[model samples]
Target: MNRKAFTLIELIFVILLIGVLSAVAVPKFIGMRDNAKITSELSTAASVQTALEACHGEWVINDAPFVCGNGIRSDSADFNATTGYPVTLGSGDDTPLDKILKNGATVHWKKSGENYYGPASDPQNGTSRCIEGKPCIGKCWRYDSAEGTLKLQTSGC
Candidate 1:
């Protein structure tokens, strides 16, 4: 009888090769994942901006006041408050960015929740800080009104 099977040496070599490949591919995969997170954050920011603009137009025309966050929410109207740009919004729930980027990412807020932005979420502990040099990403977006941008930067995963 003839049996076809991998020899012990061949199996060992295959395992070593796999180990090597994994060692090389793991970091690259992690980096790609981080980049995907950043992309998602950018898209979310764009939506928030669009919502703010739309809310602003309506508020201006109807003379109404409301807040714009992840979603459009309004109570009644703030008769005492001035008519201006709506506040920014966030996921409200803690996000995957928090766990995955605990070391190399952060979220920032520019003026207020009204213009929050930054590295998708907060860094782990001492890895990074907002452009303002503050530790953010708990429940806000780092804001940069001067440049009119909300960035979510990461340290290459």
Candidate 2:
């Protein structure tokens, strides 16, 4: 007798191999995706920082006028008097920072005192080491208006 078919034992072995491979590969893929999101968020934050610096440069070149656009020297509504950076990102198409940061479509920004916080690309539950043990859903990027610094909270992401 001649046969050309996989036996039940052979099929079972194939299935087990596939399962093992999937188990090992899936977590790595997920980790990579999370890492990518973190990188993207950090890049966006850096862009915002650069824009802030440019605005300040212009402000300095123009003699640091107290009142410029809309009676506000800074680009956004949440202008920080100390660092010359927007404490809170503005909404609307006309807002300067909105145009610079792409209208918060990718990152939602809010201000608390002189600090600005934005949502991370991915929402995960963890504590960010950078934010005084603050619990973050996704990742959180904190911008310090006084020091002109940006901090990334990647524990959640």
Candidate 3:
């Protein structure tokens, strides 16, 4: 008689194969996700860098300080007279990044798409290391205004 259903051995073999495939694929999937996150983080960093350079360019061209913002609106912000970068004050505040980024349209630097972006956990030291034990304000993509750096962290999982 033609078998209408999978035998016990066939079912077990299929289950094992699926299990093995998943075991291999799960780690790869996780790695891909981490890579994507790293890429996205780099992209965001580049955007902020471009914005900062534009501000600096304006300053260089004008030979004077420009108004990044009035600091009244979330979209508006303050910039440093010497650096021409946004006035972050290095207090773990997202205002500078947000304002420099024109933080309208859900560009909340504090939290961006399952990832948090803001100042380093330790501003005093100004040397933020998120994966080395301490996380930036509880697991975040740290933006160091002083050093003008964005720390990207990926997982081994």
The candidate that wins on TM-score is 2
Provide the lDDT at 148 for model 1: 34
Candidate 3 residues lying further than 4 Å off, grouped into runs, are 63-98, 104-157
**lDDT of each residue in 1-157, candidate 2, tens digit only:** 8989999999999999999999999999877654555555566667777866765566666544544322344644556655565555554323424534545444456656656666644355332332333323556676776776777675422
Whole-model lDDT values for every prediction:
0.45, 0.58, 0.49
How does model 2 score by TM-score? 0.57
- TM-score for each model: 0.44, 0.57, 0.50
Better of 1 and 3 by lDDT: 3
lDDT value, residue 87 of candidate 1: 37
The residue ranges of model 1 lying beyond 4 angstroms of the native Cα positions read: 59-84, 87-120, 123-157
Q: lDDT order of candidates, best first?
A: 2, 3, 1
lDDT of 3 by residue, 46-104 (tens): 77667656655666667543454323221234444554555452223334344555552
Choose the strongest candidate by lDDT: 2
> After TM-score superposition, what is the CA distance of residue 132 in candidate 3 from its true location, in Å?
10
Candidate 1 accuracy as lDDT: 0.45
Residue-pair clashes per candidate: 20, 0, 1
Question: Model 2 scores what on Cα lDDT?
Answer: 0.58
| Model 3 poorest ten-residue lDDT run | 69-78
Clashing pairs in 3: 69-77
